[model samples]
Target: MGLVKIRVEGVSKVFGRDPAGALAKVRSGMDKTRLKDETDHVLGLHDIDLSIRTGEIFVIMGLSGSGKSTLIRHFNRLIEPTGGRILFDGDDILAYDAARLQTFRRRKVAMVFQRFALLPHKTVIENVAYGLTLDGVAKPEAFRRAGEQIALVGLTGFETSYPAQLSGGMQQRVGLARALATDAEVLLMDEAFSALDPLIRHDMQMQLKELQGRLGKTIVFITHDLDEALLLGDHIAILKDGTLRQVGTGSEILAAPADDYVARFVRDVNRGRILLCGAFADAGLIAAADAPVIAADATLESTFAAFAGGAAALAVRDWDGRIAGALTPRRVMEALARI
Candidate 1:
């Protein structure tokens, strides 16, 4: 009926000599040395609660050591949670044994790492088919499927090329193809575009957004970049030290940050770029009249550029050229001032 793919409950992960004990801090005690000395045993994640809807691109963002990676890792059981539960489509993923988990990874969930995890010697087709092969898909069938996936990621003619022959961005595209080949419902991307150069990164971000828009795959995207989060996420969840700081749409966070940390994170952002023309229009500032209009879904950045000569109010007309409302530079500037 609807895609409500990944759901996470009171998930918590702790690395320490006594992981179970570290779930909650105890007073200075007999095992102080054990708790203090072991670094990995320390709690990496607190009681984290989140629900990722199917087909929605949910972004998890935080700085380094904030448990962003750890929290994401828990989704696929790469790192087992010391406490709580993870459910995939109402199934308790934690209860799945190796075979069931392997099946799940193959068919339902796929991950793209920061480092393109393609086999260096394998050709692009071979890399994309690796998952299918592991899942017992026929060699020839897997190869054919891989070819289709390669084409989907815009690596059509390079199917026979090795990972080394491709640029970093291309290699990452290969990685994406490999994941897509599985037809996985949930795509967990851990800083997928962080490794690319600025220009390349922007291209990759746009590509991923386009791909997601077309494929409608549920994505749990992890990133340290606020701009990236705002650009890609349908819903943004800000995590600080393994705890959720705030969760909302990009504009909601930009318009009203839940706390100082989130406020500071988006403080310098240009709201004109982050918010849509509809937000300003809905503020009831625009006087409805026949004038040039931009769609409600258009970005402020794009809409502002349309009014480059400094118009009083650009009419937000519909597709049929009927008057909807107006957008003013003053409203845009006011919204941007909140960031």
Candidate 2:
């Protein structure tokens, strides 16, 4: 496990004219649904507890009205929690006053939204530097830093273009660059790519993965898409009706769903597509004279691609790229047969 970046401890949110009364009802052993039914108050989230790690893409995924969005807001104190505590590095963020919270938001965390919130009047570089500008950074220094981030997101040439003149994908790049420019420890992304076309969304996913490898920034990405969660998340948390359903890696969630709801949600998932080749590799199989080489973490789907013409066995290579084991054809067959 990595160092814990943010810990949400017993966090809950209720939206109503008398939120305290509704919260009291909830704490007095009333159920989430019953509390809502009996009062005008709405339960946005109920007892959400999670430990988000540093330098990993931690995805919060669920369908609409799952309170996925509401939970994330509490991380940055966008919606003050009706109860419980939010700890950032073991300090209660709920205790932060105006000055302290402002500094925390400006320096420690940055957010990216589904709608690319760019200033139409400002050029790409200008918009990218806007956050630093608000912090009293000089124009030349801010733009210099902004230019570097621009290149990082593959927007070096479009720095002079206005947001309206750019394509939706390019406008999103500006948003990403702006977030990166602050060099914040945590990046809160709320449906950052939901508005893009399929191809563009896929490209952005790949781009985020590549960036994470180099920058190593801890990112909390919100999305309602299961496929997107499976692709991008190092670990995932599933939400439904303001309750956290499950939290685990893609494989763990797929192989062992928590309940009927989760099972139904992942029913159509292709097992072979996500299972690593090492999972199916035979430990007893000694290396042959010329067995094909494969990374231990390589997906079984990619393993199949390696044997497009067909193969009897292949050696499993570890992180150092050494042969750790081999995958016999029969063992691979049984696994693929299930799929």
Candidate 3:
């Protein structure tokens, strides 16, 4: 059966007036509810509907204050919605009591914040073990599992070092390790690499993709960077002013944006690089033997040299070296011209 790991149905959250606080204000003659009616309060998130499939990397991208963080927080009930249903594996999370919510967070979901959030005094191993320790795992076993997690995130030699001793990238690795150590099925990352330098951030993105491929965990990543969204997402949702602009696979969004906002956002994207080479094909229209060959999955960066070699068409081969398609220079120019 196809399963949805997390489903958000018309979820909406508005701040500035808690139910208890509003009642208290009215009891004290503040008329807070009426005052709220007169004010232009911020809506952190409008009615949002989404479904994240199991084992997929779903990305939410938007400018700051566009509700990306608020929407992500709803997945794990970090911020309860003002209206609508959040279902985890088909169970409504809003129905959970405090204790059950804690259980759900500890066992089924884990979040990694942008700040790393590592305990300053704790060694990397202790930091990773903190969650299990809270659940009453034995010290030896917790440390053993923590070490394996540290190694999994590329922190093998730094297990005994304190957070302050590590570089920013290394510290973030510890944060990732802590999330992995929880053994949670769903991971929520809020701008996890935004704090790093470009080089470090690029490396971390690749590392995360590799780690995800091996682990196959369901992940929801939030970011404002278009390139990051393009690089890491299996499916992407673009948000503007607390509303969804578009949701689609990278190629789908690039090939045909849903509206003006999404089109403007990706106007400068190198379509040649982003579009799949296999997509530019006619079934059974393989290239001639004398044509230059490029891997079917090759990025535009890899195919540019072949395109400049004056061949009428280039042979596109899949991993098996069988002719899967052909790429024409005219098609490449056409795709690139869309930007």
Best by lDDT: 2
Better by lDDT, candidate 3 or 2: 2
Q: What is the lDDT of residue 291 in candidate 1?
A: 42
Candidate 2, 1-339: lDDT as tens digits: 489999999988999999888988988888877877888689888899999998889999999999998888888888899999999888899999998998888778888889998998999999999989988889999999999999999998888899999989999989999999988989999999999999999999999999999999999999998889989999999999998999999878876789999989987777677767776677777767687888888877776765665766789988886677888666666665645
Q: List the residue pairs that clash in candidate 1.
A: 15-40, 15-41, 15-42, 16-41, 16-42, 267-339
Clashes of each: 6, 0, 0
- Single out the weakest 10-residue window by summed lDDT for candidate 2: 330-339
Q: What tens digits encode model 1's per-residue C-alpha lDDT throughout 1-339?
A: 255677788887777667776665522332433555653456577678888888889999999988998998888889999889898999999999999988988998899998888899889899999999999999999999999988888889998999999999999999999999999999999988889899988998999999988999999999999999998999999998767899899998988899999989998877777787766674455554544578876777876675686566777756566556678777667766653
Q: What is the lDDT, from 0 to 100, of the residue 229 in candidate 3?
A: 93
TM-score of each: 0.89, 0.91, 0.88
Instruction: Give Cα distance to truth, residue 28, candidate 1, Å.
Output: 13
| lDDT of the structure predicted as candidate 2 | 0.88
lDDT of each: 0.84, 0.88, 0.84
Give the worst 10-residue stretch by lDDT in candidate 1: 26-35
For candidate 3, write residues 1-339 as lDDT tens digits: 147888989876667646444434434554334536754345666668888999999999999989999899888888877777999999998999999988888889988888899999999999999888877889999999999998888788888899999999999999998988989999999999999999999999999999899999999999999899999998999998777889888888998999999999999886766777766654466677899877766765566787677778888877787788787777777777763
Each prediction's RMSD over C-alphas, in Å, is 3.4, 2.3, 4.9
Which residue ranges in model 1 land beyond 4 Å of their true spot?
1-3, 26-40, 282-288, 305-310, 315-326
lDDT of 2 at 100: 93
* Better-scoring candidate (TM-score), 1 or 3: 1
